[model samples]
Target chain A: TQLLEQSPQFLSIQEGENLTVYCNSSSVFSSLQWYRQEPGEGPVLLVTVVTGGEVKKLKRLTFQFGDARKDSSLHITAAQPGDTGLYLCAGRANPGGSQGNLIFGKGTKLSVKP
Target chain B: DAGVTQSPTHLIKTRGQQVTLRCSPKSGHDTVSWYQQALGQGPQFIFQYYEEEERQRGNFPDRFSGHQFPNYSSELNVNALLLGDSALYLCASSFTGTGYGYTFGSGTRLTVV
Candidate 1:
């Protein structure tokens, strides 16, 4: 089975602090997506990285895809209370692969206190 | 336009009972996918439907099955429920053949007693 390992299962930081969450896998992916989920709600797409070594920024959140397409990271700078949520990273298997689903990591729960 | 919609926001069932969850895809979407999410875990894909056919499925067993309608809506049915089946069932919709357009519903919280 294709697995994505996410680190720092839980994180709590004061406002203005910065934090980073990492997702790694041994298998290559055709694309990697980052999502943020609030309590009692489904995950909302944050960004998608399709090319290796690619980086995309959304306000204070920065996402990067590894050069090998087997890893990705989400970095939040000057975090605020609104940034607190469960962050997830999911990878789509390479086309025609046995795994056709979007394999996800357990996720990183972030709490930014003001 | 309205986003993906799921019915029966919450459900409680006993073991061995069968349950069905429904989903209506977002406007302009023709594909629907189902996922299971345990507490504190990311969603795991159960299957995907397009063109009123099962296009792909994950590692779930035959006890979990689904169907798609001509209008692109879908239904997920689970038989012989177990305690392990308790979780949030999520439905996502997107245009077929796209990798990034998935929009998920709020999810139905299922509890198997």
Candidate 2:
């Protein structure tokens, strides 16, 4: 009963390619966050999206939150080997729901080859 | 300033033994939360400590317990450890009121034999 489902659990792509990772859930969230983790390190926060149907861009990375607040996506353009890592999507339940606890997805493991 | 800090980066224990892992929250943070991540799995929330009290808990059993010190540091204790307890234990720190923008430690890898 995973609260959030992430698609393409594992991905391998060459440099300069583009890829998108999806995180879907049935329950609405107050906010969603994206993180990147390398081996032997804790996940690092990339961005946080709170408004429904909002899109945010960070250099080559683009993040979008669904209008219903139940899904999110991460798109990387011209991906480079430096983008290789585990991409995790975490959703924060609405207030008074789960005490606003964060629910995490299994994550998408990405490998960008040179 | 130092981020969250976890002790005993790695540990190996035998079944039936008790183990304690420690964490120090980031500067100015007042709340501590613990999470367990199994191999190839996402982290599952264990519990959160705020104002030296257990604020929220997940579905873990009684075998798992924790404490928060006045300085906002936390300790996670496991009683009667089982082989299945092997996993990476993470500590995240954040402000109590905001409850977001968590700062996570590298985590302690625990292996129960």
User: Best candidate per lDDT, number?
Assistant: 1
Write one digit per residue (lDDT tens) for candidate 1, span B1-113. 99999998999999999999999999988889999999888999999998888989988999999999999999999999999999999999987655574899999999999
Candidate 2: where are CA atoms >4 Å away? A96-99
Best by DockQ: 1
Instruction: Give the per-residue lDDT digits (tens) of candidate 1, residues A1-114.
Output: 889999999999999998999999999999899999999898899998989999999999999999999999999999999999999999988653223568889999999998
Q: Can you tell me the CAPRI class of model 1? A: medium
Instruction: Output the TM-score of candidate 2.
Output: 0.96
lDDT of each: 0.92, 0.90
Candidate 1 lDDT score at position A51: 91
Q: What is the total number of backbone clashes in candidate 2?
A: 0
**Candidates, DockQ:** 0.54, 0.50
| Root-mean-square deviation of Cα positions for candidate 2 versus the true structure, in angstroms | 1.7
